[model samples]
Target: MVVFNAPFDITLINAELRRHDLGSLEERLGAETAPVIDPLVLDHSLDRYRRGKRTLSAMTSVYGVTLQEDAHTAQVDVSMMLGVLQEMAVRYPRIAGVDDGALHQFQVEEHRKWADNFGSWLASKGRVDDISRAWPQE
Candidate 1:
């Protein structure tokens, strides 16, 4: 599965599945959620020092992908995300060179690092937000 923010989307899907007494996506797939690609996570991890927002729209701009329709609609967002991911692969050969399973694992660690760092930053500011370190399914 390719998603912009796999954590948010997968979490929401699992919540709905649980609400209806169904298996989570990972369970249904009969394996851990390997091979799922999240462009947002990839971009953040690969381009850690880039300035400005990392929203889908912003990323599309960064990747030179022209969004042909209004943003936020499911179809439009998916199309733009794929476009952005293609551009990412072109610019970041490492992303294309790694296998999907390895990439997924890399993203899991990257998300944990990001959450820990961001949570520490929040704590330093006296805020108590507990950022989740779970990736792709939390």
Candidate 2:
């Protein structure tokens, strides 16, 4: 189970979850123990980096997900994670049926597509260490 530490913002978090078919960050409407909130810096004041927290927050909002603010960590089921990825395959036809971008005709290098890809691209180019460094500023 990969602990996805994302940045703040509801849209991005939701997209990430959607990209992987994660239904509602919080399965329970008002469950405190539900692992929904991405374990990342949420409030800017709390974490200046604003990387994982912001990314996770964005994804949550995009999917209308809400977890107890007090519980800022969540576990991702491997099967569910795979399902989410399977759904992502149907999202962009360009990358459909292709896992490693080997079957795509073009390059999917857009930062807004996914926060991790953006950060990964940056790291590949020696711009940032990881997603944590790609957090947007306030």
Candidate 1, residue 115: how far the Cα is off, in Å:
1.0
Residue-level lDDT tens digits of model 1 in 1-138: 898888888899889988898888878888887678999888888899999999999998999999666899999999999999999999999888898889888999998888888899999999996888888764
Q: Rate the local accuracy (lDDT) of all candidates.
A: 0.88, 0.38
For candidate 1, what is the lDDT?
Answer: 0.88
Model 1 ranges off by over 4 Å = none
Tens-digit lDDT track of model 2 for 39-138: 2321222233434535444544422445335433334333333333344344435445543333211221222335565567788888964454332211
Show the lowest summed lDDT stretch of 10 residues, model 2: 103-112
TM per candidate:
0.92, 0.25
Which whole-number lDDT from 0 to 100 does residue 89 have in model 1?
95
**Overall local distance difference test of candidate 2:** 0.38
- The CA lDDT at 113 in model 1 is 86
